[model samples]
Target: MQENFEDQESVEIQVGSEENLKIFIVNKTLLREASNYCRRRFALELKYEEEPIILNGFEPLIFEIFLQWISNPAPRITYDPDRLPQEPWLSNAATAWLLGKKLQCSDEFDKYALSQFVQNCAFMTFGPWELIEKEATTGSLSRFSDHWVAWNYRLAGPGRNEYSGLRAARATLTAPVRDPRTFDIEHWYSDCGKYMRPRCLHDPITRLEKLEEAKRPKPIPPAEWGRSTELRRERPQ
Candidate 1:
C-alpha cells in the first residue's frame, strides 16, 4: 500500500519548553513514523495528509500545548482570527479536557493527557488534500487532528466563528442538498464511509438504507471495480 502512494523522504523535528514544539518540512514517511510514535506512546492515531507531493517539504509549524497554562496554570481558550469562521464542535475534546482538569475526572484526565501527548508529539496539526472541482478531498490514511479541533469548537458555541475542514467537507456534500434525490451514498461511502467507525451502523434501518446502495456489502465484487488504470494514469505526472 505504501508503494502505491508517494512516500515522504525526509523530516526535521524540534522540541521546546512547555509543549512549544515544532515540526518543519516533513514528508509522508516522517509523518507516518511520527504518528506511529504517538500511537505507541498514547494509543491514539495522529491524522495527517496522504499525498507525498502535497506534503513535500511542508513548512515547519509551531503548536502551543501549554499555552492555556502560561497564565491560568491550565489549558484556556485562545482564538486566532486567522483561523475562522469558527466551528463550534471543535471544542469538545479540549473542553472535556478542561473540565476534567478542573473536576479531576480520571477518564477526562486520561483524554487530556493523550491530547497533550499528541500535541507534544506534533506541535502543530495540519493536512494536505486533493482539490478537485473546487472541493477538498482528504486521504483515508491521513490523521486530521485540526479537523477534530474545528469540530470541538463548532460544538462549543455561537460565540466563536471557526470551521473544521472535516465538517466543511461534509457540508460541501450536504450544503446544496435541495432535492435529496440527487443524493448518492455509494459515492459517499467510497469517499468517506470507508474510514468510519463500525458502530455507525447501529441502526438497522439506517444500515438497510445505506445497504440499498449496493456498495455497502461486506466485500465488494471484483466486477464493481472501476477504471483504476485510467485513474492512475491521470494522477499528477
Candidate 2:
C-alpha cells in the first residue's frame, strides 16, 4: 500500500556534519511538496520516522533558510550580511541559490533565490566570484551564465575579470546583431541589455563600432518624405 505523507505531522531532519550538526523539525507534507530531494528520499524510505533524516553536505544556516521558506506561506528571506557570522550577504545568497538547485525546490523558491542573488550582485561591490566561476565552469550554474555576464558588465570588478573566458563565451553566444534603426532604449537598460551593449565582453574597436551604429539616425523613407512635402505645399498659410 502507498503511504500517505499527509498523515504525518512533522519529521526531523539532521543537517551538517557530526561535529556541528543541526536538527530541524518541519512539516512533512510541506517538505515533501517543496523539495524533490526530500520527497524522493521520503518516498523511498519505509521507516522514515524511526530515525532523523540525515542531510549531509549542507550548512545549518542554508538548511534553516530552506526550512523557513518551506514552512511559511510567505517567506521573508532577505540578504543581510549580519544575518550570518563571518559570511557576507552575497555568499549567503549564493549558497541559498545553490541549495535550491540541489534540492530541486519549487519554482517560486528558485525565482526568489535567483532574484536575491542577482540583486545582491547589483548592489554589492564584490561577491563570491570564485564560487560562481567554479559552479559555472562545472555546469552547476551554467544556465545562469547570462545573468552573471549581465551583472559583471555593470560592475566590471577586478575579481570577475579572472574568469573572462567563461563570460566571453556566454557574451558571444548571446550577443545580438547591432541595428541602430531597431534599437530599443528601454531594453538597453534591462539586464539582457548589458549583453546587447557595445561595452560587453568583446573587442574595444568592435564595441566602439556598435556604439556609433546605435548613435546613427535611421533615414526617412522616400515615400514618407514625398507625402510630407506634398502636405506642406497644399497647406494654407
List model 1 lDDT by residue over 90-195, tens digit each.
Answer: 3223333332333233332333333342333222232222221122133211222322333344454455333433444443322321211112222222433333
Clashes in each model (backbone N, CA, C under 3 Å)? 33, 0
Query: How high is the lDDT of residue 187 in model 1?
Result: 21
The window of 10 residues in a row where model 2 has the poorest summed lDDT is: 179-188
Task: Return the clash pairs for model 2, or none.
Answer: none
Q: Identify the candidate with maximal TM-score.
A: 2
* Local distance difference test values of all predictions, in order: 0.32, 0.57
Q: Write the per-residue lDDT of candidate 2 for residues 1-237, one digit (tens) a residue.
A: 111223457777777888878777666778888889878877777765446677687778787777666766453244343433333435576777677777778767765665455445544455565566666343223334444554454455454463466554355444444332122222323454444444442334566788899999998876646878899989999
Which ranges in model 1 have alpha carbons more than 4 Å from their true place? 1-136, 141-150, 164-237
For model 2, state the Cα shift of residue 189 in Å.
19
